[model samples]
Target: MTPPSRPKLSLRASLFGRFSLADTGHDLRPLPQQPKGPISMVMRLGAMGVLLGRTTRLVFSARTDKGDTLRLAHKFANGSAVFIVVAMSFVGMIMVYQSTVQLNRAVGDTQLVGAAFLKLLVRVLGPTVIGMLIACRIGAGIAAEIAAMAVTDQLDALRLCAADPIEVLMVPRLRAGIIAALSLVIIGSCASALAGMTTGVVLFSMSPSTFWNFELIDNADLVQGIAKAFVYGVTVPIVAGAVGLSARGGAAGVGRATTDAVVGCSFAIVVLDSLISLMSHVVAGL
Candidate 1:
């Protein structure tokens, strides 16, 4: 049996869509039109802009709830622990193996393998690769969570209660994102470096002494890697929250917002990585 087709207009929507009757009983009324395509896109973008601006303000505001933020941070940390460990371990191994193979093929000696891999992994790949993974998983969750809240009028109720959703919701996610991103990158970077060094020792016949001499990571690299982690941490949840809060169209809207959160956060992480690398180079040169 075919499922009944859902009415285009709810009782409320039908009431809202009603117009004055024409003289003829046979007069046909057109369906109420929803905003289509580009207009909807533009409106969504504008809404995201406003939401992000508010979220950023909330992140730095003294009035935002600290206890709630901390609670959220703790929750995300505990929840994501296994995922972080497994994902980073595999990513680290892959990064090391891939970099080693490419460099060794080109240089023959593979002596610079550790140095090259460390340079790229610490400053760029660590946060970004990890962030892309988070954007797909955690980011989508954040978006859906907020979007569900918005669709259910929970966000509206919060506003009516004189509570700021930005503080209670987005700020905590931002904190969680930073904590998660940084933790993952550090764990992943160490794992990757170890994998690279081990590969150099076992596969490339590189002596442990020589591998150590190549200098897997330096103080500057450590600092830069942490900075990248912080940046990615800040980026993902804010984007997710913005998309989520702006969502319309109920579950379908939440789904779109979730998808956008994934794609937007991934793209943002890659773009930010490039920008940060360039800025770091400029600063280092100066």
Candidate 2:
């Protein structure tokens, strides 16, 4: 005998059943709650303590590193800075003499020519001294520090310790760089101005008052130049530090990082200077 006929399924019911099964299969399970035990609590506390300690150490290390870098840079390069300043001063003197002589021939005023030469000399000296000082001191130090850090794997260790390496290391260096740059600009400008005045009086026979008469020698230009230097200082150290921190392999990596830091910083300085100059012109126009 034939078995009792099975109930025929409608298309809509079949579709519904299939969808229901799929929905049930795809439903997500609730996440398990973490066990609340004494051991777990202790572990959590220990982790927090380690985090706090690392943060404290990072802050302290940044400050100490910045101070040490600045000191070393100044100590090692002081003599070189002085020599550069002297050489630039002499060059300024020669340039001024030539400029003044040409002007004198054109205008038939030898006295005014000598006065112009003195003014030019003073203006050129200050900037020259500042540039050389920064180049020899801050520039080299940044390169070396980044290279050493790369060589030592200090940066990698920082990452392993869960530190934001850039904030800890780069920010302080950037701040120090700004300070150094501004100091160099101010000191260099004064040195150059004095040298120019001296050359005018001794070599070109110009009066001190006449040499200092130009309004361009005042705070406006000096401030603009210092601002440019400040940008350079901040950028150089940061780029150097970043390069060093990202270095890999071994000695070869350190060498590459060091070279990249120097070349990159120098190029950055020139680009920043140009941008600042353009901005200054725009501001003046406004």
Candidate 3:
């Protein structure tokens, strides 16, 4: 005889869908929506802290697949190169053009434009813009991919094999992301500088040597840029992975996760940039 039919359990979603309940074939249920407001913020922060701690432990104290990390690094770098270069090149050109226009209209001194621009690019624009761009591009890809896997039950398969998905999937991306981000930041910065130099020369008839001056930039600027890029690199994957892993449903869930990843990564970049800049200034004042 067939097994007795189980009772049909009906559950209702709460307002804002935070506690939406669904019945998967194996009694699977969507987790509560991540809450908002101050208390929710605190709770999420604690959860993220735990996640980062676990990831850090896995990366440093355990053996990760070296080949996988390298492969992902290569993919991240190559895939991002053209986008970063072209975008940065345009940014450099626009900034130079605008600065020159403003300087010409005001005090008639364009000599300081390149110097000041270089300083800003190194300490602010290069790292920050690259971070934002990577958040939009790479972060979305990571979220979509992971969300798809999660929705399709592949993550469950990993659990069945006694593997921590974070160790198997996210750790490599974290390592590879850092490597790729640093390299791309350097390349994008060079493209921006060169494009700015060319813009000054072509548009304003400025001497190439004069516009290429590096007088305003120092060790501090270099350190800050690298630090920002490094932080952003680490932040994007973790944020994206977290969002993706939380995904449920099917295609709609993947799309939502991708959008969330972009928004979350961008916000993280802005907050980190502000904090890093604040710390740099505080330290420099000493």
* TM-score against truth, every candidate: 0.76, 0.62, 0.87
Model 2 Cα lDDT, one tens digit per residue, 32-66: 34335785444333422332334334544553456
Candidate 3: C-alpha lDDT: 0.82
The segments of candidate 2 whose C-alpha lies over 4 angstroms from its true place after superposition are 1-84, 108-133, 160-163
RMSD of candidate 3 to the true fold? 6.0
Cα lDDT tens digits for candidate 1, 1-286: 9997754543222221221011112212334564668865564455455555656676777376677667766766666666765676666567666766887678756666667666777777777787787788778889999889877878768766877677777777887778877777777666666766776677767776666553656777778778878987887887788777756678898999899999988988888888877887898841
lDDT of each: 0.70, 0.53, 0.82
Q: Check candidate 2 and list the clashing pairs.
A: 121-196, 122-196, 125-192, 126-189, 126-192
Q: Weakest 10 consecutive residues, lDDT, candidate 3?
A: 14-23
- Candidate 1 Cα misplacement greater than 4 A, ranges: 1-49, 60-65, 212-219
Please report how far candidate 3 places residue 54 from its true position, in Å: 1.2
Q: Which stretches of candidate 3 lie over 4 Å from their true place?
A: 1-42
Total backbone collisions, model 2: 5
Model 3 clash count equals 0
Candidate 3 C-alpha error for residue 263, in Å:
0.3
